[model samples]
Structure formats: C-alpha cells, structure tokens
Target: MGGQVPSKLTEKFDPHRLVMRGTQAYQPRCIALEGSVGVTTRCSIHPQRPSICREVLPSWESGEPYPQCDKARIAHGLSPLAPEDWIRFKDANASAA
Candidate 1:
C-alpha cells in the first residue's frame, strides 16, 4: 500500500477551499449543523461530518482566526468571538511565569 498522504486540493472544493456536500454548499447552515446558529450550535453528525466541517475548526481550537466561525456568527446576528473569549480556558499559572 502507498503510504503517501493525499493532496488537500482538487475540484469540488469551495473558495475557502473546503469540500462541501451538494446541499450544504453555498448554504449558510448545513444539514449536519444543528441547533440555533447564534444561541447554540452543535454538529449532529460530528463523527461523520463532511470535509468542510472537519477542515473549518473553531478559532480557539486551532489557535488561528477561522473566518467561517465569524461568518456564521455574524449571519445569525452574533458577534465574532473576541481574542479574550477563551480566557476562561487559560491555565491559572500560564501568565505567572
């Protein structure tokens, strides 16, 4: 078996460069994405989510600003997460070095 990893680029990818399902493509909310957009949200089929859902991680999770997170938030009239939004998760001694 070839032990080579597949390239991330190919046709059937969006401008954000994510592979989207036919119905979810260009649609703000995905069939897999459940719950309210602004108030609360969760992936119903997280274990079997599409490539787009897997690729587009939350900003705090990847430690980089993910525009999809912000876009979704704004679309539902919710503010984008602030840099300090994840402060609660910080270690107590992280800044005491």
Candidate 2:
C-alpha cells in the first residue's frame, strides 16, 4: 500500500498522513510532497494497495503479462488494451511461466 494510515492500523486517523496506494492512483496522480513522491509511510491506510500498484490483473484478465500485453497493444499504434485482449495476451504467455 501507499503507507496510508489504515483504519485498523491507527486508532486516530489523519487522512493527510495516509499515503494513497493503488486505487489511490486515481487520486489526481499527484503527490503533494515535492521530494518524497515515491516514499510511502510505514503505516499503510489500506492493507490492500491499489491494483495499479500491485499490478493486479483485471477480473477478465486474471494472469496476463502486463508489460508485454501493453506493449503489443501499443505496437499496433492502437488504443489501450481492452480487458478481453489483456486476458488473451496474458493466457498466451502463461506457458512461459
């Protein structure tokens, strides 16, 4: 997670101290602190970091290779990969595991 103060972790909650993790990625995509952008606090707000951070595949694409899948989509000069394409791309690369 993004070192946020989880409800379970801290009795007193300070949203500011909470560093937003994965889902938090949607939160403006801008960290306020100038120098410490990537550094996450010790106490995480959510036990589960955002999907983007954890690189969790979407429901449709359970075990896809994100980078390869993403690159392939871009190589064609196409838009972002759709969920179904991601699923297929991931599955095709599964044997490489």
Candidate 3:
C-alpha cells in the first residue's frame, strides 16, 4: 500500500488504513493527485462520485459561501469571494425563486 504513495506524503500517512476506509475518508488516497492541481477544477469522476461528494454544499446556511471554496480559489491564484458576492448570490437566487 505504501509503495504507491509519494515519498513526502508517506511519512504521516497510513496506507493500510487508507485502503481499508477507501473513499470514506475526508481526503482519500484514491482521488489524490501526485502533482499540483491544473487550471480547471472539474472532477473527472463526478458522474460516479461517492455520496459524500454529492452531499457537500457549495455554501453554508444558504446565503453564506463556504470558506473552503475561498481557500481552494486562493490556492488556484484566484481572489476570495467578498461579502458583496454573497449578497449578489442571494439576490440572484431570490429573484429566481
């Protein structure tokens, strides 16, 4: 199990547990990328993704965007969504509703 893991990540990782839990873990080894993420954020296996993936909401409490979304955007060199962004999102949804 440990044989496939990257040298850097192997130090703290328990490959046996990873294999046992599979996709149930927060950050599964199966979906982990060896290198940096590309420009696109699309999931290749979205169609067959686990229930956990389907359950994750883009935002929390309807109007407020999730902080993790901003963190990922920042990691990809994009600006974090501001408070005004949430206001606009809520306004757009309210009109649609």
Best by lDDT: 1
Each model's lDDT: 0.58, 0.43, 0.52
Please write out the lDDT profile of model 3 over residues 1-97, one tens digit for every residue: 1234433322323644322223345644434333444443455445544444455555544667777776766766677667676778789999999
Model 2 alpha-carbon drift over 4 Å, by segment: 1-47, 50-59, 62-80
Sort the predicted structures by TM-score, highest score first: 1, 3, 2
Cα displacement (Å) at residue 23, model 2: 10
Question: Which structure is stronger by lDDT: 2 or 3?
Answer: 3
Off by over 4 Å in 3: 1-13, 19-40, 50-56, 82-97
* Candidate 2 per-residue C-alpha lDDT over 30-60 given as tens digits, one digit per residue, 9 for 90 to 100: 2222333223323132244433345533333
Worst 10 residues of 1 by lDDT: 1-10
lDDT tens digits, residues 1-97, model 1? 2212133322245665543333435654454556776667786656656554567667665467889988867877888776676775465447765
Judged by TM-score, which candidate is best?
A: 1
Model 1 residue 75 lDDT? 75
The order by descending lDDT is 1, 3, 2
Q: What C-alpha lDDT does candidate 3 achieve relative to the native structure?
A: 0.52
At residue 69, give the lDDT of candidate 3. 70
Model 2 steric clash total: 7
List CA RMSD, all candidates: 8.1, 10.6, 9.5
